[model samples]
Target: MKIFRRLLSYLEPYRIFLIVSLGAATISTLVALGPPYLVKLLIDQVLIQKNLPLLNYIILGLIALYLLHSGLTTLRIIYVNKVQQGLIFDLRNEVHHHLQRLSLSYFEKRQSGRITSRVINDVETLQAIVSSGAVIFTIALVTLLGSLIILMRLNLKLTLLAMIPMPAITFLVVMFSKKAHRRYRQMRRRLADINAILQENILGIQVTKSFRREKLREEKFIHKGEGYYQANMSVIRIWSVFFPLIMFASALGTVIVLYYGGREVIAGNLSIGGLVAFVSYLGLFYAPINQLNEVNNIFQHGRAAGERIFEVVDTIPEKEKKKAIIPPSFLKGKVEFDKVSFTYEKGKKQKEVLHQVSFTANPGDLIAFVGASGSGKSTIVSLLPRFYEINSGSIRIDGYNVKDFKLGYLRENIGMVLQEPFLFDGTVIQNILFGRPGASKEEVVKAAKIANAHNFIRQLPEDYETEVGERGVKLSVGEKQRITIARVMLKNPPILILDEATSSVDSEAEILIQEALEYLMKGKTSFVIAHRLSTIRNATRILVVLEGKIVEEGTHQELLEKESVYSHFYQMQFKENGKIIAI
Candidate 1:
């Protein structure tokens, strides 16, 4: 349940690597203890005996010990690196899966830059704490404990004197670590905020240039940059105080040992070789102490990332209950919204966006929702795919409540195209084929031809292999929209949603896409949200929504006959052309 244990789960597959690495580190730490002891033995036994013949053998033995220690250390570091690489892959994969399943509303509220930071920057920081710092701290700690035992055994009085300042340093480290942790957590959050700003600015660079707000944006960026800079400096200040204090305490301990042990050696109470070994181990003691000072700082940032990652994964996913009251083996594209009332929490007054809205679309029906901005046309279409849950009512498909079907199964049967057609950075053919993974090249080409995109695609230098560039920026808006349409056509779902599909394209392109839509809408239940009434003039049914309620509904001719809300929309455009064409 804790962030640490949850994060550790990502490393589960590398259990063997962790165990082996820790073992090697332990053996390496113990083996490292051998050399200084060997030096003591050489001084006390071999050199002290005036035996020059054994000097060559002692040197050879020392070389072998160093080689063994090197090999053990290499093995330990290799496995730690292996675990780190694997864990990053796993954590990224988990984040990716959670992102995929999260409702569209979640993405609507979160920044892409912040999400990117979690996937990239946070993952790297987490791997550092889990792999490098964790392993090193563990080994350093064991070495410190093991060395203290040996030192105390050799000479308790000198060992006690050497360790006298350790407890005070330990208390200080704990206190400073807590403070450092708070500062580092703040630093990571500030970094995320800055990344969010940078990401947004880059995406809207065109708008910024158009509005001549370059200087204004730069000032905003500078402000965020300053915040991050200050947060980082806060961390630096803590480290500045921490590292120096830890070093002074360590130096004080060594000074005490030297002062007391020198007197003992002069009084014949300590051996020269033993005194030399004591001095050698002093530096090793400080190594672990430094890591101890910084471990909390490492953990705090890692936990912050873990918390962010968990916030996404642990969300209460869209409600799909078991033991369905109405279950259908297959969807029939018969959708009905009964007494549906919905409101977004953040909207003004928690105002209902859809008030007791109800509609029924028979199979092969072309149902279009027309309304002004903030009139909930898009929101109604979005609900069909369960992008957002309806506040009060049931949405049923083919006499079965939509909630009865498996989420994936329900989505797989519905096709949707948004106002802004998004394409991944891939070939034209690849982007078109994305709607139907595992689709053959023939199917992909066929779909492109239907959407009127195949001709332009073949004219490109690489044709099907030509990169779309980021979000298909290399292609014109009409080209991207056509490619998206082809993708949806390739999918061939029973139900379709077109949310201002041609609104982003030019007039000529809209006419071309409308032809494609005419064919795509045949033999399927469809919902269209359009600001341009001509786009949906041929729709079988048009519903005029105003203030969360269906103010008018009928065929284009029927609504125009009544001269209500729908008539107002239809006549405005007709009046612009100085002629009224009856729908």
Candidate 2:
């Protein structure tokens, strides 16, 4: 009920449409009542009295009543659908916008597919409830009340007998609603699971095919599909029983009305015409009850979907301090980490990934971090941009704590070129412009030339206008990496972080990229995380990270002379590369 109310509150902005829909529904229901009452007039007053002129009038009136009812019903449906569609649009926009505001950790906790399902599938599931189903439900209640009043006025005794099944029907509805809501919730969850698996497999199809595990993936999909089927079947099985029980309850009312009304008529206590109209009105009353049963199904299904949708909508977004201020437009690029610590929460336990890590990069300093994978090298640089908040101590840029700066302003001054470049599905120019949307064509070309990407881009069919495909799949690995570098170059921020940016390319590409990096790092405080120690040999400062701590820090030659962790790693890499020059 709480979820349902929340769903209704979304309709507040569209209330004018909903009110118009309800108004049309009300008039339609009243017009509908006229026909059955007219049937009574035709039978008792006109047909029996042999008044042909009045019979013609009654017939024409009935036709007019139906036409008006039909027109009003059409108007109601249009407005109802208008309300439903409008609500979906607003809800989806809010949910997607909220998702964008969420921190990276929120995405890390859930699959991309599950999150997508909430935005697309789950939000779509509310369509039926807010459309005709909602209007019908209201009309049913109104019709039930109106029919009851008329029934009592016509024959109090038969109306009471006809309603004997009401309490039992009410009980059935209560029981079905409780069970159906739970079943639908379970069904919705299973459906989301299937979507998750499908999305994962589709994205990893290349991996599956390369491993020759297509059959294995197929079997997994089939297993999830079976779960969805079973869940749907569970709902179907209950529905099959519920619909018949409702019908049987309604049928019992008709039987009660017939047997007792027949006795009343035979006893000359009731008119034949009145009994017929009583039965007709009785059908009208039960029709809406039965209709309510169907509407209940829609409401239950919507409730399940609404819960999932709101679950994402209700999640607390990334926090910014109320007093956060924009940093100066011209940043000095002095980054300092003072005993920063960070713990990652995985289920019940917490793993401290960075332990009192401290470092300082003055303006124009080329700082390098060399460490084993998962040694917190990337996490150290990520903290500079405030991607993840620190558990202790402070990160200050120039003299202001990172938290003191407005998040967007602080990040705008920092740029990153990651190992795996991600490009949106668009042209090369568009991807390059993503770094700084307002950059001009000449500026873009200059950045590309500096990154050594312009030569190959010109050799392509459309130069900068060529489509990159998803994640720049149309381009070579080197091409994509260079484009990302160009993007960062275009950003031309005061601070730059390169995370294994050259590890995946060939030697020729690596040389071009290194040359580009040298130019990009000029006049900026740079942080580089690299497995190849040769790349960082000229760095102004080198830090060796181990087990989430900065174990050793010095120049490349100074670290080698120390003959400690940095020296060990450098020597090992030298052996692998078969190079031992003068140290």
TM-scores for all predictions: 0.93, 0.96
CA lDDT scores, all candidates in order: 0.81, 0.87
Query: Model 1, 1-583: lDDT tens per residue?
Result: 2878877777788999988888898888887777777777778777778777677777888898889889988898899989999988888887778887777777888888888877778778878877766787787888788788778877888887888888889788778767866676777778888899999999999999999999999999899899999998997887788788888989998889889888988999987788888877766766788776666667776777677767767886667667645445557799999999887664567768888999999998999887777778888888877877888899988877788777777888899888898888888878877888899999999998988888998998888988886844378888888888899999898899998888788889988888888778789999988765565677889887887789888898898798597677567765475222332
Off by over 4 Å in 2: 471-473, 575-583
lDDT of 1 at 345: 68
Name the candidate that leads on TM-score: 2
**Model 2, 175: alpha-carbon shift in Å?**
0.5
lDDT of 1 at 512: 84
lDDT of 2 by residue, 1-583 (tens): 8887888788898989999999999889978887888888888888787778988899899999999999998999889889988988998998999999888999998888888888988888977788857888889988888898889999999999998998889888888898898889988888888889999999999999999999999999899889889999999988899888988998999999999999999999988889999999999899999899989989999989988888888888877888986567689999999999987673456788999988899999999887778888898888888888788989989989999988888888998989887778998899899989999999999999999999999987888998896744377788898999999999999999999888788889888998898889999999998655566787999888888999989997888787687677567666578332222
Per-model clash counts, in order, read 0, 0
